[model samples]
Target: MAVPGAFVSSILLLLASAAVAEIQFSEIRSDDRPIIPLDDFGFTHRGWLELNVSGIALSKAGLELGNLGFFLCTRDSWLNVLKELEEEDITCALQSSHVKHVFTFEKLGQRTSFDVEFDQEDANQYTLIFANCLQQQLRVSMDVRSAMYNLDGKSGRRDYLSAGKTILPRVYYLFSLIYFVLAGLWVYVLYKKRLTVFKIHFFMLAVLIMKGLNLLCEAEDKSYIKRTGSAHGWDVLFYIFSFLKGITLFTLIVLIGTGWSFLKPYLQDKEKKVLMIVIPLQVVANIAQVVVDETGPYGQDWVTWKQVFLLVDVVCCCAVLFPIVWSIKNLREAARTDGKAAVNLMKLTLFRQYYIVVICYIYFTRVVVYALETITSYKYLWTSVVAAELATLAFYAFTGYKFRPEAHNPYFAIDDEEEEAAAEALKLEDEFEL
Candidate 1:
């Protein structure tokens, strides 16, 4: 063995050449870069590319590949990839229990390759080895780009929401703007009418306008967090608007559902009491949702309290059913006696039923879609919700406009007659006392 010094030197030289030959480095130093659009043209071209890239190379280069695509998560390349993999709890399966401190290297140009063969047949073993080599900053001569060329599929298509960006429909925002204008006009009309019956109509229109504004804000900016790096304020406003809309709907339902002359005073008091209790509870629940669930920086758990508020809202809605039944019974009794009161009651009842029918349609559609994933895309679901809301509001506004109180044909003419009768009864009681 001592007599083979020349042979030993030759063997060392051969090993060095083989190590250098494994990777070929080439660099093109011209500015003629390819312009890639964000969409696919045909089968030949694509917007994204995917290949089984080495994670070690990605860590060293300060890039990471996730379902969301490539991200330069941090300036520290090696730390960034490790952190990302650790977050997924995948880095603990490395072949080496600890990364080796001493690692070989060669300084070459770009286009690095790992032509070295491995005995491990498991593909994940190779990934672990690459991760270890990267952690040690070993012989990665040039930038090793193991990232797969992928078609950055930005389509929001999935059974459940996936990491993707979706283009929002602008038409919904335009329609929401129109809805806002119409709601505002109806509110003005209600103000001009100056009748107690139309006050509920005014409140309902106001809530609809707020909901439209919330939709418009979401359309303007789809980001959960804002450009200012702050939590979105519009989300809190949305919850408030939604809660108010629900409460106002219940109030209107109770008002129109109880169409009896004898029991009208008691039912009106009950509506006021319901508002007094429900409004505060709704406000508090919405505030809790905003602080803890919606735009909160902490645990964004919406399921627990979301169901609670929804249950409260549903109960309030269902409570109106009894009033509606009683009102129908009262109307049938009144029809046998007072023709005019019964006619007005029937008209109001029809309007209320129409409103409830439209609301029920929307509620049922949303519940079904959300529960069973009937609609594949959440973006489309949002659009449908806005469309439903706008359509319902338009129909309600049309009905109110058509049957608005006027001097020639007042919608609630019985109200004035009833007030006159009450005043006459009071005068007779005073005369009897005298």
Candidate 2:
């Protein structure tokens, strides 16, 4: 038994050493020139290059123009693609110049075949196209092929194609459907009887329509059709409309703030003023971000400007959300102090039904995610926006059910009594002054 055990141990040790030796050999072999010539035109005619499978390579190359060879330089690009595939459970690939020039794939087999073809008869110019090969999987590939071909004019075409066919159109149609349904329902409720909450709901519906229109315009422009959606006037309008979308958030903040102010009348004057001040400041900052993004260093230095805007927007959002949440908490405490159980129940009911506020919070969180994606250029972040909007629409639709005139009568009566008391107090003060 001891002899057998000793023999087994010796075999395991030998296998481990052999594995280490193979790894070391691979590292050494990978150092050799990546490009191997099948035909002897050595420097002149470059042929299909096979990636070295022995070792890991970086993500992107430092040198721009060179013979197609196996090397990776930008680590983030490769990691990002892998992460998207893993996290989303979707197949992904590098298709165009937007991603790094190098492509990375997990070694699944001995060899993987890639097909290449040139459209125009220019030996100097060749396009290296990467397509999705995963069976029954949605693959999102970056627009990175133009860089490989050195095709200046056609650089944006493939990306635009993918955006039109897959991304933008889908988003546009989904949002449009949601907007129409919610808007129609709200209009029907208004015809039955007007509700103040429905006004805000309608406003939200309008926002959805505006967003859908903007996306539609973008999609139409990118689609490769006869009329190449190139209306510069419309483009300018879209830019302005995007800026307005950011401003609209401030409007929501104001609406929520006013609602909170009504619920908490004892808030310090200074705090109230500060909250008001933050609203316009946030609006200005958001507009400035759009301007800077369109006309300033953002065009030249995307990464830096993206980070700056994200930081600013995040700070502003936190500044706004914090006070509102604090005010809501204070209101809840104050409601508890009311002596009558009936009054407390009414207050709790009103508070619980503030789905508008909840929807707005959801919207704010979505904005943060959108801003982060803009900075990081992560494609997956877009799906979050779609989900958020869908949720907001659904919440608003449900909230509309409580818009009957009878529901507001109780609150309105209370409001009238308060107004009468305030008027009487004011008359007393005026008489004393006289």
Candidate 3:
């Protein structure tokens, strides 16, 4: 009798282990996606989501829900309901949101499955939240698959791309073409003025080329993701180009502001210090930008990465301005106390114009465009992006035009006639003294 009892106990223990093995309550992301943000929000015909669940045993996990297994709601609604769920239960929160997708699991300890197709609505961020009305007690594991497809043929946007970002691919392509054209024109100018070209001229050319490639890669990356929800390796290329473009652009801006190659052949100690600070900040900003772009709201630490990106970007913007201020002061003092006041006046005016342009670019891109995005209707969301690109293009054109290599350029170098006149006057005075 004792031997038989031991054998029965071993069998019972095996059965219990097998039963609990199905309960996977950990944060393993292989199957269940608890939170999904609907970036592709629209009004009339948003899209469709096909949801499937398998191997779900919510009740066995010690959840005593009357009927609800899971549900979906707008992000705002989700945030609002959390406090209620903590104070009361999931049912209390459910009563407030009638406009939600609710799924029910009724069986107990059975491997049950249910699939649903929902027509998504609302022009707000939607989220998918799994229901544990009584709060999950056991670690339950389940398989869930969700696929979103578009039904609006007129919008011409894939379901994966958010409505506000629908036109980004086109915008990137257009700007990439523009940058390529400008780069070709710059090459022509450089070849024509090869005798007067400085190292800075080539650096500008490189920046233009990098900008074009960066935009091209970005266009491809967004286009692919919009179509298939995957970058197909374009994202890697985009990241590389984006990193190179960011570093080069800031470096170019700082170098030009200090007149490193044109006004002077080498950087001053302070100028070098500015470069050191700005470059590292740019690197941090770009890395944070990459993290923000790659991670959705559902991803861990997404908001933190976005905040880091914004902070570092603002710091880099402020740091770049210091060199420009130094340049303006030097030009102002030269105009006031030097013999070539008129020449310095021309350079001073150029620097001031550039300063204003930089400030306008930063302000419009950072503040005004964000405000536009927040307030603009969903239909007109792409306009903010267009405005930003337009501002960037204008800034680029103005900087290139003002700083182009040329023989005895008035703003960049002393006028040849002015130099000749000063030399002749000095020679005449020396002859009179002899």
Candidate 4:
């Protein structure tokens, strides 16, 4: 929810610096996402905008106005507020403003804490605007540290979370719970076939555990922020787990694509090269995620970091496909050359299916979910999370089912009769060569 890279910007409410953070406007910034977007992310981050004003250096005109020179309004009404401020007869601002908080400049010290509030009637997203309306050479300058806190009222929740993503905490937890169940099931399967289970099976389980932990941490991060404007150490756990999950996930994908631990005990030189490239790319991607989360679009290098994250993500995705392609090609050639064409054909089909599934998983998470987020309403943002998680779960299950260990597992196991036939064929070939 309100974890790193949760929202598109730094408008999230930070409660405690022990783990989570808040949006701090060190200067009166430009119009690059200056209108802070407020949402509950499913009330996982349900909190209010608590603005701490500092360096209250204002002009004579600002002193005359006697207000903090900020405006909070619903997103729809915000544009109207701006349009109204453009006209000379702007007395309507005090009356027409959707957010009624008036911060008087009188007795305003170097640091003043102003808690912002709004009514529950309006069913829409709220935005915080920092501006000096008079527009005469831009007079007011202040350092604002805005923290989000949960309003512990039913009416307040209805008002603050009008965009309706309050279901995200539950959504993540629900999926986390599902993964927990799936993990249990996987363990059972591994135990039942413990004699047949390979090292890759255990690796798959670790990936599942990491993914579960990541989602659980994310849910807690949002929930903690919602309740107290801080995630304590939950945010830290989230970031750590998130990084682990990312790295492990890509590694697993690359390993599985190359059929490592199944068909081969060690990576080939070229396969090792692929891991060398993919792992570092994942690191870059995770670091970019953190930077994007902590710094807003207002930050100077925001665009560059966004580009870095996107580029690295796409490259990593493309990189993982290479091993799968090689595996498929190798299998196709083996099916033609191997005397046991029946067995080789089975392996070939499995690899082709693996390639298709990997492509689909990448497409759904990277491409489909992105389009869903852009096209859907703010209220349905949780759907993107759900869709991505579901696709991942399906992929995981399919991989487990198709590759689970067994004596007669067509993928890796050959019948005794086929083995005998293959031996005879090899004997004949050797005799002919001699």
Candidate 3 regions with alpha-carbon error over 4 angstroms: 1-40, 43-46, 52-60, 65-93, 102-109, 112-115, 121-146, 152-158, 411-434
> Model 1, 1-434: lDDT tens per residue?
01123322222222111010101112212111111001110110221112222322322444221111111111122233344455664442132223221112232124233332212111110111111223233222122221111122364211111112122325447756877887777666666765544444555566567657666665544433212212246545656566666566555555655543323445556645655665666676566555433321111132345445556655555555555555555544554456455354545456456556645644654464344332333223344444455555655565455445444443354576764553444334321110
Candidate 1: regions farther than 4 A off: 1-172, 187-198, 220-232, 259-269, 295-302, 339-345, 348-352, 355-359, 369-373, 377-383, 390-395, 398-403, 410-434
TM-score of 1: 0.47
Query: Which lDDT tens digits does candidate 3 get at residues 236-334?
Result: 998898888988988998998898887889999999999999888888888897765554333445556766887888888888888888988887666
Task: Tell me, by lDDT, which candidate is best.
Answer: 3
Candidate 4 displacement at residue 219 in angstroms: 1.7
Clashes by residue pair, model 4? 13-148, 15-229, 42-165, 42-166, 44-222, 47-149, 48-149
Error of 2 at 48 (Å): 17
The candidate that wins on TM-score is 3
Residue 369 of candidate 1: its Cα lDDT?
A: 31
Could you tell which candidate, 1 or 3, scores higher by TM-score?
A: 3
Model 2: per-residue Cα lDDT over 80-171, one tens digit each:
54455456543333332323333434322323333223232222211122222331222221111111111223333222121112244456
Clashes counted in candidate 2 amount to 14
Worst 10 residues of 2 by lDDT: 17-26
